[model samples]
Target: MVMTRAANIAFKPEHKITMLCLSSSGQFLSWADQSGSVSLASVGKNHTLDVKGNWHAPGTVVGLCLRGQRAYVLDDVEGLFCVNQQGEVDWHVPVAGGGFSLHEGPTDMAVVDALGRLLRVGYDGSPTDLTSQFEGILKAMYVSEFLVLSFEDGSVKALNGSQVVWNRPVRGEVGESITALGMDASGHLIIGREGYALVDGEEEALEMETWCLNGQGLLFRSDLKTRLTHITPGLGSVVCGFDNGSVTHYKDNQHQELLNTGFAVQSLMVRQNHVVVSSWFYLFGVEEGSEPWKIEHQGMPMLLESSNDGSICFFAGEDQNDWTEPEPIGFFSLKSEARDADPSELTEWFQRPDTEPERSAEEIYRVDETVENLLTEEERMLMEKPPVIGLDSLHAALDDFAFASPDDQAQGTLNVDAESLLDDLDDQLSSMAMMPDEGLFDALNEEVVAPIAPVPAAGEDQVVTCDEDGTAVVLLDGLGSEDPQNRIVMWSWVDSTGQEIATQARAKVRLSAGVHRFELRICDSEGQWSSDTIQLTLK
Candidate 1:
């Protein structure tokens, strides 16, 4: 995403910013200062104007959460209060003892009082005594169907709605009361200041090389693989910027690359197809296979948030010669290019002769001859993507396609047994034709129904272990069918977090810990769709 950015002033206040939070709407950023000054900014335009409300609450603002149009804040002396976008105090309630941290759940909010009480609150409602209703819960996070709780001593418990599912003992002895409790990149529970422990998956400290920048006395909010200063979530993979001036790409558990930049990165975020990395004065927009597009920033940005549409981005930082108030630097219209060939794969692509095509011939997109003939010229052009070895390589794959690695090829010895597959496809097709339901044909809207094939079936051990470099490709192979429309004309590959990694049948993915469910939506030529889902667990 190469976006054109502009600089604009957000507000005029010199309060030392302690907490920064972006709203779920992607508009408006609410910040709390050391003096307990809460300000709001509507941040979707070319610039952020001072639409902030006036909140002069005393005492330090310990916790801040913005949901919808209200900002939920907790102050030492002021107590828990809901502030609307207009800066009006919507509701105020005293904290029985004192609250430290605030975590948002799927349906409600959970606050940790000093006495290990979990005070729950609704979106716009006042805080209640949910802590008194529960047992030994200091911090509570209700995720999915599991209620993950962290206690004062760094212990965690997962309860599946009133039933104890799992309990992880205290990670280590703590010298003081728990300061913070939250989840980490691994989907594991973490107790700040005390230590972090993996509650959901097995913990293997895969340490990678990291860097350190001088002067910042901040302890890591979450100490991941390295001293990663910036993080951008990716489909099946994660991009991390380390202090060592290097950008590392990881999938599964394998560390991928060394996009070495001498300057320390402050932020890493994905904009469309590009990964945006920010340094002290530069914002680098990197697309696969091309040099990173660098844009100079006025100064170090304390906070950067872009819209979901990727149309604009706003950063909270001091401009040159001004450290009084956080100015809004907006970048607009970052158009992103859709690249097919993987940038990670370009490391080898460049090693080959310059005259050679960027991708292998086998990578070209292909559909059944029936699909080619049935499609309009425009559809035909779009449908035939490039060099994709979808169905053509099914039989000849053993001889033509070189295995990604020797071990993978050794395991790839098994191919699709086409005979039984065709029989099964025929049987399913016949059954479908005989069924009384006419929904399938009606949806097709075609008088002549060409025989479509079943989606490719998985060979033995369809799920393979992470390769030597920590990448795993789930091959959509061994599947056989004879139905004309059954030829998969399109593919949708989605990761656990709903990020689509690939549109091709085969998915080369980086899986996080625990069970990751991915759904593959395949459409045949006749506008019919079929889905194949798989759950892969990464330790």
Candidate 2:
């Protein structure tokens, strides 16, 4: 099945179902119930439908015929109402008395009513009674330019208005009634009576004299064991569904019995080589070698039709008592969906003559595994590791690390103290040596060594700038001469927890020369910090 079982829809229980019909293209299925309302449900992609009010007939819907988007419904009122796909009434033609039967034509409908009135309906939604020749009620009718009618005489009559063009009295023993009637492609009348022989007209019987008209009105083409309970034409086959739930296919005068369906066959339709049958709750399909699939429904169906896209729609529900309650009506299409199967099992299945083509192996047809998985290994290698940087690019490594984040400024200040402080003057001088061969010495300003520590006037501070490499040069200043130990400090970063990330603590410290928070504290001869501790941040 092309669609899944879960896709089935359930409607409100109280909405009565009157009739159901599908569009010619199978694009939509229009259903109407006792409320005289119709819903044109889309078959594929949904469309914005134009909903109409209520139906004119509150009675049970007897039959329905659709053309373009307009539908003609025959209901209990015995009248014909022209309704759009949305169930809105376009127009109505009330039969003078009551409608009996209706047949479709090229652009109009031929209607026969209970009063034995014959009428021709034009595209304009108007009715013109052509004749009235009824002894009782009109049961069945077939429409063309010329109409054929079965009357109380157990005879078939071809009529052109009130005048009879020709009449063929059915040759039968007695008591049997006309079961089915239709016209073949050659315009010869085909009738099925309650007796034995299957008959052909005078001209057609010449080649096949085996099939002759009998007194019981049953015509048999041959003495062979073949029974045709109901017959309908197909493109290349004649479909005759039997009473035993078996649909027989006849092609070139040969017959093939299909699956022994357990349900009574109600109707048969043929559109080419495809055969569509509507039995009790089951729908059957027969192709070449595949098993017949029976799609079962919950209600009894009254009509079946196939769409051009190969989907079928049928009417099923409560046909007798309550026509108001809508039943479950469904659409079915033949399509294959992907399923998971083992490779070897799938190969064996495809090798079987009856199985459909293997869609999962389509990629294997173009290339083998060696060519298909070419880029897999290379892609895995690329995903395994981060990109590598050369050792000479150590500064690039530091650039990747988040040093002094902007979020660390929430706290007050950061302080640092060293356990061992180098007091060698030469070591202090070496700290100012420039490594010009490397990029680290780019920010060195050696000229500031002469006035390393300067006494400042009261309330004076100094400003220092760092190079593009984030290295800052610090000089001790703003201390009185009474303080012998001059200290240079830089405050780099303070985290949210008041922890110092990196700070400079020395008389003259290189401190790896990066951004840091510094605190310069000058101790006087009494070993006291000048005034109070001061803090600054190096770039």
Candidate 3:
């Protein structure tokens, strides 16, 4: 199904994206590609994005964070760099053993390298090494004046200047890895693993269930069909996206389903009144009292950032290695109509005709009877007849035919010279069994080019009201139509009566208060035609 709202591409990098970061206010976006190229864009009004600057990193970027108009990038080979909006590096610090995570504090930034070293860098780019007491650190987060660390042994510790604030030992069986960790609005640490979570060292099993903690330290749990992949706290409710493609909202000891994407949800973000969900290659935006709108991406959307008032959202991610070219990051305003499908449409979508149904015994017998009735008299006789000769009898018959005299052969049913004809046939068969020429094999192995199908998008349907003149001027758009080779040579718009009205990609026409339909047909260079129809309702 096509997306109801069109998603605008902000910028496309030359290489595949490796990491993406969006600022807390959703005003600045920064991304890095596989080629070590980094770019920063400013999300302007109406969710429009403009690339402000671009720079090249020394190595592959592993982590990225944005603060205001500047970007903090951590690469695998180099340490870190604070870049301004004009592509200028404000400062560069050589991090030992490379970096894993980068977090921005109120005045300084935190960096965790590959060797479990935590360093805090000031605004002037001077990095002070913190304690390295913890080994095999998997993740580190700097919040307020404390550093929270999770280890490979499933242990967690919060430190304040070498002083242990609180520690939680491994809760599950030995070697169980931590899957998610975050701080709620009430300043409570929530740590999630495979089948459960730990709230202040208290075990909460979450198998086949969902849970949420409100701002008042109240915990709520609900039964679920699958495990949760992502959870985001909203204004008065908590939304959770599951591995089964369902997004559920829980609040006031009640739950309601938002939408199901039919694919494993990858990420989620919540704005004031909108919930943005990402699954596979599509992003869904759902708002109160409105159908959810979707925007399809060329790659899986891994990063989602939304504005404070739910007016705009920006998303970006790496390509899934299936496209001929890498996809760009995109931003869209939530005010547009981006509905995907309703409940009935989704039901019809999933019931595909993949295989034929089994036939009943009576139906099978009727099919056999119909086949028998279609056979000719000769075919029926051949089916009833038995083998005419055994193996030894066939050999005797051949021997007799080979040695028969000319007069005896004439008396038999055969008319041709059996011995001479057999000799020639053997010679021809021997020659035919030989291998063919290399050129002939090469011709057989040549690849065949398939015809390219043109995609004709007639744009969205429109609804308008007539002016005092009892007519309205409407614009019919077919610019979204495309051919892969950029070979679209002709565009035609036909009215309901099969009358050609326009021959351009876009046309303006006047109509009265009535319902009208227009069909847009596009022709490619290869003389292939594809068409799409759009409806317009006027009042």
In terms of lDDT, which candidate is stronger, 1 or 2?
A: 1
State which candidate, 2 or 3, has the greater TM-score: 3
lDDT of 1 by residue, 440-502 (tens): 767778687547455743223334566665544344432332234445656676654343445
The lowest-lDDT stretch of 10 consecutive residues in candidate 1 is: 209-218
- Candidate with top lDDT is 3
Q: So what's the TM-score on candidate 2?
A: 0.50
- Tens-place lDDT per residue, model 3, 232-291, is 667464676777888877555455889999998889888777888998877876787777
Q: Rate the local accuracy (lDDT) of all candidates.
A: 0.55, 0.49, 0.70
| Per-structure clash totals for the candidates | 28, 22, 1
**Would you give me the overall lDDT of model 2?**
0.49
Candidates in order, TM-scores: namely: 0.45, 0.50, 0.56
Over all chains combined, what TM-score does candidate 1 have? 0.45
Poorest lDDT segment (10 consecutive residues) of candidate 2: 203-212
Please identify model 3 stretches exceeding 4 Å from their true place.
1-4, 44-50, 128-132, 142-146, 160-162, 195-225, 250-256, 337-539
The deviation in Å at residue 322 for candidate 3 is 6.4
Model 3: how far is 250 from its true place, Å? Answer: 4.2
